[model samples]
Structure formats: structure tokens, C-alpha cells
Target: MKKYLLLTNEELKRTAKPYLIVVAVLMLLEFILTAAITKMHEGKIETFMRENGVSMQEAIDAYGKSSFAQVVASGPFLLILGAGMMVILISAFVIWYRDWFGKTNYIYRLLLLPGSRSSIYFAKLTTIVLLMFGFVAIQWLMFFVLAPLHDLLLPPELFERVSIAAVLERSGLMYLYDFYLPNFALIYLFALLLIVFIFTLVLIERSYRKGKKVIRIFLQFVILGAVYGATLLVINSDHLFANEKGMLFLAFTFLYLAFLVIIGLRTVSKKITV
Candidate 1:
């Protein structure tokens, strides 16, 4: 257990360092740009109101209906943040692949550890999950930090305060987080299932080499297709099951996760090559 924890911590540090640096740089840029652009738009509105002899409320109402207003409301700064997230998602696969295929062949050392082979799988999985939550925590903290900074830099009336929840809602991430803060369990489960599926595929490829590679790849597709077909059958039978489709889907996903995890562990322990 201690060794597993140590391995996980080491992997987390190795995987997170570069990713965190990129995330931090992008986050800082987004913060500065969001604040600068928002303040600029507010200043333009104020100048227009002063020049036209219109009231502050009237100026605000007019600007609110403009294209610039939409941009400000949606916050283009999030685009950089979103791109960073996509990079992290792709890195998840790279993290696993590089261990096996890198110059060091780290997977050979990892497999030779005096513990269960599943520990390697779990350690990498934990590293990825930790990085994901770390990103989310940083994003949440940024919202709080940027909100107050904006308030201090801009006038109270011009700066409309938006909470992290509101920003996430607008960005469509809240739905993934299940719209409510406490629903993070759903997010965790969904993320775990995805990671498990990916790991299963990785194991399948690792378990075979040149001779039967095409057949092994075909078998993987067949397995995946069967899982998908089963899921669809459950979903389409919603009417027969009294419209409990959501529950049925969740149950099916959990069952598939278990099946994949078992297969992945077996392959990693017995068939995977260094």
C-alpha cells in the first residue's frame, strides 16, 4: 500500500508538472484579457452615454443588446481555458502510452515492482483523476479571485458580479457537473467509466503484437459494439421498463465498467509486453 501510494504520487508529479504550467499560463492570460476587455467595453458605453447626453441606465440598456455585450457576457477568455482542458484530456492517453513506449521503457520497471500489477493501473488512474480535480479546483478558485479583482478595478455598476456557478452554467460545463455542485459524484463516475474504457482498449492493444494484431483489433471492436448494443437495447426498452431509462443507463454503464476493469487487469497482469 505504501509503495502504491508512493508510485501514484511520483506519477502525479511527473504528469502534472508540464500540464499545470500550461494551465497556469493560459489561466493568467484569460484573467487579464477578460478583465481588460470587459473594462474597455464599460468605458466605451460610458463615453457614448456622456457624448449623447443619455442616462446611464439607457446607455446600459442599449449596450446590453449589442454584439459586444454578447461577447462580454459569454467571455471569450473561456476559449483559452477550454483549449487547455482539451490538451489535458489528450494527455491522459499520452501519459499511459509514453510509459510503455518511451526511451526508458518505464512500464518494465513498473511491472517488476514487488506488488500487484493492478497497482500500476490504479496509480496511473489516480494520477489522471487527481490532475482533473486539480484543474477544476484551480478554475473554481480563479473565478473567486477574478471576481473580486474585477470589482476593485471597475466601477460597481459597470461590473456585474458572476459567480463560478453562473460562469460554468454559461460555458455548458455545469451540465457535465450535473448543474448542482453536490452532484460531483455523477461526474466522478462518468469520468471513471471513460478512463476504464480507454484503459481496456490500451490493454487490448498491448496484449497482442504483429501476427494476430488485426484479429485482436477486430475482437476489440466486436466487444465494444456488443456493449453499445446492450446499452441501446436497455435504452430503447424504456417503455417496457416503465420509463426508468436513466436508471437503466446508469446500471448498464456500471456493469460495463466492471467488465472492462476485469479484462484490463487480466491483460495487464498476464499478457502485456514491455
Candidate 2:
């Protein structure tokens, strides 16, 4: 337990600087987006009033007031969403490469530690999951701030009342950052399963010779393809198991998750070499 905690702390320390920068930058950009989008919305209302010679209330009634939901649908927000997801997925993969990339051969030292390699594996996985949750928590809080800021920027008559929940619900942001317990739990499990799969694939292929490396890579993709294919097959087969396909699929995913973790632990402990 002590070793695992210590290794987890080291992993967090490795990622702290860039991780904090991404959080801070995301917060600042979100603030700017809220203000800029609201101002543009305000300007649109003014233009409507000017062209039609109507009052603010009339313009709003005619043009429909803007809300945080609209801001999320804007191109800038979608771009940020895409970029943030890319950063997250890249970070997940890069956490492994960081130790392997340089001349230090850090993985050798880690593997040689006087303990089960599972400690190292769990520590890295825990660190990545923690960092991801931290980012999500901070972003969740930012939405509260941004929602009110959005409301305050526009004239009351030109602003459609919107709470954080309403904004997320209406904009479909909930799909990306769903806070509901069951939904979030499922997403978290899928994320864990994915990270484990990626870790296993890298371990199996990382040090292989080029000829064998290609084969290993092909095998990794084949596993991935099989998972996806099985999912599609089960999900679309409505007649299977009297419409209990959801439970069946969950069972299949759980089994696959266990398989990946088992293979990963074994590969790290016995197979991989410096």
C-alpha cells in the first residue's frame, strides 16, 4: 500500500505542471467564450431593434433571447470540446511513453522494484483516473460560474433565464460530462476499461522487433475490432435474451475488462524487458 501510494504520488507529480496549465487555460478560455458569445448575442438584439425600430422587449420577443445553451452550440465551444477530448485521450496514451521515451530506461527501474508490478500498474491507472476526475470536477464548477456570468452580461430582456442544469441539458453537454450517478459510473468503467486495453497493447508491443512489432500491433487492433464487433452484434440483436441485451452487453464488457487487466499485469510482470 505504501509503495502504491508513493508511486501514485510520483505519477501525479510527473503530470502536475502541464495538467494545471490545461485546467487554468480551459477556465480562462471558457470565461472569454461566455463573455464574447453573450456580447455577440447582445449585439444581435441591438441590430434587430435598430432595423425594426422596436424596444428591447419587442426585439427579444421577435428575435428570441439567447441562453448559455446557444453559446455551447457555437463553433468555438465545439472546437474547445474537441480539443479537450484530444488532449485527454493523448494524455492517457502518453503517460506510458513518458517513462519509456528517454535514455533513462525508467521502466526497467520501476519493474525491478522490490514489489509486485501490479503496484506500479495500479498506481499509474489510479493517477490517470484521478487527474481525469480532477479536471472534470474543476470544469463542473466552472459551469456554475460561467452560467451566471452569461446571465449578467446580457440585458435581462435579451437573456433567456438558464441554470447550469438547463444549459447542460439543452446543449447536450450532459452526454460529454454527465453528472448523473448511473451514467457517470458507466462512463467511468468504460474509461477504465479503455485505459487498461491501451496499457496492455503498449506493453505487448513496445519492445518487440520491427517484424514482430507489426504482428503484435495487428493483434492489438484485432482485439479492439472484435470488441467493437461483438458490441454491435449484441446491441443490434434485439431478439437476443428477451430484450435483456443491456445486461448481457455489460457482462461481456466486464469479462473483457478483466481479461485485459489480467493480460496487462502478466505482460508487465513477466514478459516486458528493458
Best by TM-score: 2
lDDT, each prediction: 0.72, 0.80
Q: Candidate 2 on 1-274: residue-level lDDT in tens?
A: 9889999999899889998898788888988998998998889889988999988889888778888888876889878766766677677778878778855778878988898989888888888788777866887788888888898997677777777777777767776577666567667788778778778777777657778878987887898789879887877875777437756667777888898889878878887777
Evaluate model 2: give its lDDT.
0.80
Error of 1 at 117 (Å): 0.7
Candidate 1, poorest ten consecutive residues by summed lDDT: 64-73
- Per-model TM-score on C-alpha atoms: 0.81, 0.90
Best by lDDT: 2
